[model samples]
Target: MDCTTVSLPFEMPADACNVHLHIIDPAFPNDGKAASQIGTVETYQALVNKLRLPRAVFVQAKPFALDNACLLDAIQKFGPDNARGIAVVNNTISDQGLEQLHNGGVRGLRFSVWNPDNAVVSFDDCAPLSERVKHLDWNMQLHMGAAQLVKWADIIRRLDCKVVIDHMGRLDPALGVKDPAYPFIQEMIDKGNTWVKLSGPYLNTKTGEPWEDATRTAVAIAEFAPERVVWGSDFPHVTEKIKPDEVVLTEMIATWLPTKKARQLALADNPKELYGFV
Candidate 1:
């Protein structure tokens, strides 16, 4: 779908933040793992204009691996007042490096266990790193599949800082709320330090477009913790061969939250608090 041609049916709150997106500018060198298509800050600004989501969190894309120059540069260009970042780093980073990232408006560190072969940081690095950044009040953002979620449930619960689960825990929509991992997800949310991002529905959907099957899992999470949820466009959708229309993705929040107040929390309030956006 041509996302640029589409517009949201309703106005988003002034502070609404798109908590998950990437900035892949070719101006920066990469480790040859970047997305096939380049997603520059200018390209993302067009999407921000189209979606009318004024705030954002620039997640460090995998292509750059541990080199956060592209992500940090995008945040600076976008203006830190309206942008925050989540970087990918390991325990070996110096204290000065961490502070530099913190000053760069980075409030979280992302660890991916889904693709270990290509992952920059492993599950083993999550705990110590979480502790390392705890004093900075940075959260630990996790990207893992359902099986990995179950496998790391114990460690996730014991983490020293806030947790944000990427892509709705990468749950399989075919399983819906009955997925065995659902219980683990519930426990994490009930712990009050964890949040779920209502993004990437297209990744696991059995039904396309409106993605009803995936929406069910999102609705269940919203019902479980309305204030503990946030929304993301997963913009540039690097993983998909055909990108899903982002307008449809934005509108899905209405069905997932089912109320203006709930939408307010997920869209605006929750993100401000979690990302430490002023």
Candidate 2:
């Protein structure tokens, strides 16, 4: 619905501060407060200060995906200070409400099972919330499809912890990414404790230059192990009808990594060492 109309070709580096970004509008409300997409959080912080993003990690989509807590107090009040979060689990979550969302900088825990009638959590009840979120080291954000990635690949291989298969694994680009579930995400990136997010190629490109099927699936996932490839700009892109503009999603990530040192290690040192962002 004119979801932030997009159009891009360039403009991102003005001495880009190690390309920092982490925005989440997973419909941004969970009843700890806030809505109207939280008044677009100053219009997504003025589009990350007009795309000179130095740091941003605002997230909120599961304060038990909302029945009341006012969207987790409006994501702790319009999330900032390099915000970071991801929540939503029920079974009356306790352990002090998961240690008050792990001291309110939640690492991760999103599960959607891609429209099992808007599932809140499944994939076998996410192994006791992945065993109480593996004692708070979190990370279990699945949005599966790609034939359910080898039927949840042994529940992401016996859930020993750490996992984040969001967009890439949704690969289908008309089954051209050598589909066979692309070798089940190349055996979960050769089991070096999985992590992935070559961010949603417009929901797996039915065509419209979603980086031409996400640039050969991001060079076959940076040759299947570029330190567990990471990238994101899914910002405010909920239920897209073609909405992705943050300088054209950073020039479609420099045309999907067309160099400039693999676009400064996939947009600044691989998500600052995979979300430890410093």
Candidate 3:
């Protein structure tokens, strides 16, 4: 069941980078809670080696809240060239501290508005936080479902910095194309001010594996605006019962892309641009 030990089923262009992955460490102080608790930095490095991608972005785990010590530690170990970090922050984070995070290879701040249990930053907080980091040329990453996206579309439109929306935009299966969020997400992709991750189909799927309904959204977006889409493994997949085989994930992404060059672009070039990787 371990992705780190499984052989890659499909060949990935070596130049590609993984845009989403979490390194959860339970040792960090939380509100008496534990993180997803995956293997350590060395173990993650092993998964990276198996995948054969040198660049990755480590998203702060939900359990860790604002304490990014484990995340910071990994960034230092991986060095700025190979790793970028997405962090969580409260309203009080100082400008100097932000500069330090940037210097240490952190490129973006993340907020969660969907999962109420793990939610730290509220919608009211996004504006000021967006304003604060707008000057850093950093994006504001969000882990929210489609309903949340549509509900907050007005303000999201006004963000000074770009936005990176997670998990194939995670539209509800029942909504289909008629979903209001679909068009808005399309608009963001069309406007070139937003990017979405083609990751974690299992979480939002009803039919499973290939995620047929989710595919409807992802494929359409890829065809509509290939450049605005990127791929991620969401590795060591936290809190799910049916563990995903990385090979299946890779194959599924390939099908969504449907061409060698398209896969290459989504897997490598697009991520390099969004993540600032050389």
Best-fitting candidate, scored by lDDT: 1
Which structure is stronger by TM-score: 1 or 3?
A: 1
Model 3 regions lying over 4 Å from their true place? 1-11, 31-36
Model 2, runs deviating above 4 Å: 1-43, 48-74, 79-84, 87-94, 97-99, 102-128, 131-139, 143-152, 156-165, 168-178, 182-198, 202-210, 215-232, 235-278
RMSDs, each prediction?
2.0, 15.9, 2.3
Model 1 agreement with the true structure over 78-186: per-residue lDDT tens digits = 9999999999988889999999999999999999778888788877889998888899999999999999999888888899789999989888788977888889888
Local error of candidate 2 at residue 142 (angstroms): 3.4
User: Whole-model Cα lDDT per candidate?
Assistant: 0.87, 0.61, 0.78
Candidate 1: RMSD over Cα atoms? Answer: 2.0
Top candidate on TM-score is: 1
Please give, for residues 80-167, the per-residue lDDT of candidate 3 as tens digits: 7888999888778999988888887888888877787668777677778889988887888878888889888998898988799988
> Which consecutive 10 residues in model 1 have the weakest lDDT in total?
1-10
Give me the displacement of residue 241 in model 2, in angstroms: 26
TM-scores vs. true structure, each candidate: 0.95, 0.32, 0.91
lDDT for model 1: 0.87
